[model samples]
Target: MLWVKAFHVIFVISWFAGLCYLPRIFVNLAMEQDGAAYQRLLLMSGKLLRFMSPLSILAVAFGIWTWWFYSFASGPGWHWIHAKLLLVVFLVGYHHVCMRLHKNFVAGRNTKSHTWYRWFNEIPVVLLAGIVILVIVKPF
Candidate 1:
């Protein structure tokens, strides 16, 4: 169980690295006027998304394993776990949105400004803060 929790934290940190960075790449993509630079940023973002996908999967798997063991073995008053899970679901949805936005960029159909992506890039930070607080403090 300790191993599981450790791996969960490891992978979550890895996944969050990409989640926090890909959008910064998008910010450059949005601002880039040079064709070569735009294409380069697109390649970087695509590769990053691919690399992080497995990390995200592993994180979720370990998280679920930990959650199952702790929630059931301990029994009751795990509302904080439930809330953290909800935030995780939203985080996953945010990842999906990033993928969609990447696709839009690939298609040369992105309509959002760099400012929008700058704001978007802050999302995972907020989610991560919430998750960490829930896990550490278990605030009801």
Candidate 2:
């Protein structure tokens, strides 16, 4: 159970890093006006997808395990659990949005923009802060 908690925490951090950084990368990718920009974005995003996919899988697995295994009796970080779940929903949407962006980048279509991505990247940051607060403070 402690091992489960450890894994859950580690994966959650890694997952959050991936979630945050990928969108930041998209900011640069979005700024490209020509196919070169698209090419760079496609390559970088593809590489990042490969690296982050496994972390996401780990995060989801440990998160579910933590929930189903320890949630009720121990009251184990329920606020964090809830917040992470909400962030996970956002992650799912972000994942699909990344896919959409990937397709567009591969097809030589410009994504949104650095300006758009600057604000866009904050979504995960806000969610991360909420998750961290819930985990640390458990204020609910």
Candidate 3:
């Protein structure tokens, strides 16, 4: 069971790796106006999305299952769990929005500024920090 946790953590880290790198792709995607380079970035985004889709879902499922398996007795208080859940919800929402944005981006419909995209890139940093703190500190 503990070994299962290691696998879960590995997948979670992989999913976060994809999430972190997606914004860098957005930077490249935003810079391109057209042609083969733009097409290349678009294709990269699609490939990354395909790779991440299942891993991200498995991360969520494994996270929940691990919690239910080990922490079902309720010892560290529900506050920590609640906070973690909220952050997970935010992650899921962000991923969904990113998927929609990627679709629009590939279609060349999104004309967002590089400035906006740069700001958006910071979101995962903050989110990952929050999640890490909740899981690590478990601050009452």
Candidate 4:
């Protein structure tokens, strides 16, 4: 169980790293004016997304295992767990949205500016902070 938890944390960290970095790549993509540079950034985002997808799955799988197998006793103060799960769901949605955005970039149909992507890049940072606080402090 401890091993599972450890790997869960490991995968979650990797997923978060992807969540953080992918948008930065999008920022570059969004700003890129040259066709070659745009294509390169699109390839980079696609590869990064593909790499992160499994880590996201593993993180959630281990989290579900941790909840069901090891820590099912949800009583008072466990609302944080619910909140964390909700945020995780949002994160998963965000990941898929990034994939769609990558597709848009690949099609040369991206309408968003680099500034928008720069702001988008900060979203995962905020969510990561929220999730870490909920998990570590379990503050309801």
Which structure among the candidates has the greatest lDDT?
Answer: 1
Off by over 4 Å in 1: 71-75
Give Cα-based local distance difference scores for all models.
Answer: 0.93, 0.75, 0.85, 0.90
Q: List TM-score per model, in order.
A: 0.95, 0.82, 0.93, 0.94
Residue-level lDDT tens digits of model 3 in 1-140: 78778888998899889888887898888888889998988889889989998998999888888878876636656578778888889998888878998999977798787778889888888999998998889887
- Lowest summed lDDT across 10 adjacent residues in model 3 is found at 70-79
The digit string of per-residue lDDT tens for model 1 on 13-120 reads 999999999999999999997698999999999999999999999999999898788654343667787788889999999999999999999999999999999999
Candidate 3: stretches off by over 4 Å: 71-76
Q: On residues 10-91, what C-alpha lDDT tens digit does candidate 4 reach at each position?
A: 9999999999999999999878887788788788888999999999999999999999984674888788988988899889
Comparing 2 with 4 on lDDT, the higher-scoring candidate is 4
lDDT value for candidate 4?
0.90
Q: Is candidate 2 or candidate 3 better by lDDT?
A: 3
Ranking by lDDT: 1, 4, 3, 2
The reply for model 2, stretches above 4 Å from the true place, is 35-38, 71-80
Q: Model 4 Cα displacement at 98 (Å)?
A: 0.5
Native-referenced Cα lDDT, model 2? 0.75
lDDT of 3 at 107: 75
lDDT of model 4 at residue 129? Answer: 89
In candidate 1 the C-alpha lDDT for residue 125 amounts to 100
Better of 1 and 2 by lDDT: 1
